[model samples]
Target: MFGYSEEQIAAFGLSFGVGAFILYMLFIIGQLAWESKAGKFGTFVMFLGLAFGMVGYLAKYIIRWYLER
Candidate 1:
């Protein structure tokens, strides 16, 4: 579709979906910190913990890229 192969189209859709999900997760984390009255330090800690999944996903992609290359 739109001149892209099926794999490329699927990848684009999945990438957008993943990006939206990550944004929603971050918003929820921010709301949690605000409701809990977590100050700057606490908020930082919350994000650090919450972002580990994203960091791991990124690391996996990086490792895959290097290995594939």
Candidate 2:
């Protein structure tokens, strides 16, 4: 069990925000000029990683609530 207070929850949000921003800026934005096999594959993987990160972050609390109860 993760024993986190309100401040910790806010920190999670902050960290997630920063990470998501970095992912979008570095990977997502790079796709704008991608036209090769490696670039395309890299872009695809980056998108999946980004999606998973967002989904996991948003679902953490909901999943924890369900499992805890």
Candidate 3:
């Protein structure tokens, strides 16, 4: 479709699409902390707790790149 192969489209979606979603998730986490009036330490803790999974997911990509080198 649109002159692009399925693998190309899928790669684009996995890279840019999921990247955008991850950014949006960060925004949501920040909004949550803001609405709850979480102070600096509280906000830090909230991010550390909530965004941990995202960190791991990103790390997986890094690890794969490193191993493939």
Candidate 4:
């Protein structure tokens, strides 16, 4: 396509886009915990809130795989 193969595009999307987002979310969770002095329960809640998008993205992948089959 745009001077890159499908594999190259997919690799960049997963490795850079999704991977960077996950890393940023982890940083956010850690920062929330540290700045707020959140205890274990609070930290868990923060993670669940912040990381839900990532979880949904993964779930979509799984759902698509199953539906395609």
Candidate 5:
């Protein structure tokens, strides 16, 4: 579709699309903290708790790149 192969489209979606979604999720977390009037430490804890999974996901990509090199 649109002159791009399936593999190319899938790669683009996996990379940019998921990345954008992750950022959006972070925004949502921040908004949650703001709306709830979480203090600085509370906000930090919230992010540490909520965004921890994202850290592992990003780390997997980094580890893969390192292993490939």
Candidate 6:
């Protein structure tokens, strides 16, 4: 409860959508890692970029977790 109105809360949802995308990218790292191990260097680079993008989202999650305590 950040004390925002319903509309404001909905607006927050938009940001959360972005955060979710980051998490999804992180999850995709597994697939990329596998491809890399299989000798697909190009796919590995692509996956690494995606996982890096997710780092910001992962940081957000960490912050949220700490705040909840």
On TM-score, the candidate that comes out on top is 5
Mind giving the per-residue lDDT tens digits that candidate 3 earns over 2-63? Answer: 99999999989987898899899999999999999999999999999998988877888899
CA shift of 61, model 3, Å: 1.7
Q: Estimate each model's TM-score.
A: 0.69, 0.37, 0.87, 0.64, 0.90, 0.43
Q: Regarding lDDT, does 2 or 3 come out ahead? A: 3
> What is candidate 5's CA lDDT for residue 54?
96
Q: What would the per-residue lDDT of candidate 4 be over residues 1-69, giving only the tens digit for each residue?
A: 889999999979985799788888799789979899999999999998878778877787789889999
Model 2 pairs in collision: none
In model 4, state the lDDT of residue 24: 82
Task: Tell me model 5's lDDT, rounded to 2 decimals.
Answer: 0.96
Model 4, global lDDT: 0.86
Which parts of model 3 have CA positions greater than 4 angstroms off?
none
**After best superposition, candidate 5 residue 35: deviation in angstroms?**
1.1
**lDDT at 36 for candidate 2?**
43
5-38: candidate 2 lDDT, tens digit per residue: 9898888877787677857765654565374444
Q: For each of the candidates, give the backbone clash count.
A: 0, 0, 0, 0, 0, 0
Write the residue-wise lDDT of candidate 5 on 7-69 in tens digits.
Answer: 999989988999999999999999999999999999999999999999988998899999999
Which parts of model 5 are misplaced by more than 4 Å?
none
lDDT of 6 at 64: 87
Query: RMSD in angstroms, all models?
Result: 2.5, 7.2, 1.1, 3.3, 1.0, 5.5
Better of 5 and 6 by lDDT: 5
**Which pairs of residues collide in model 1?**
none
Q: What is the lDDT of residue 58 in candidate 4?
A: 78
Worst 10 residues of 2 by lDDT: 29-38
- Better TM-score candidate (1, 4): 1
Ranking according to TM-score, highest score first: 5, 3, 1, 4, 6, 2
Off by over 4 Å in 1: 1-6, 59-69
5 or 6, which is superior by TM-score?
5
> Which model is ahead, 1 or 2, in terms of lDDT?
1
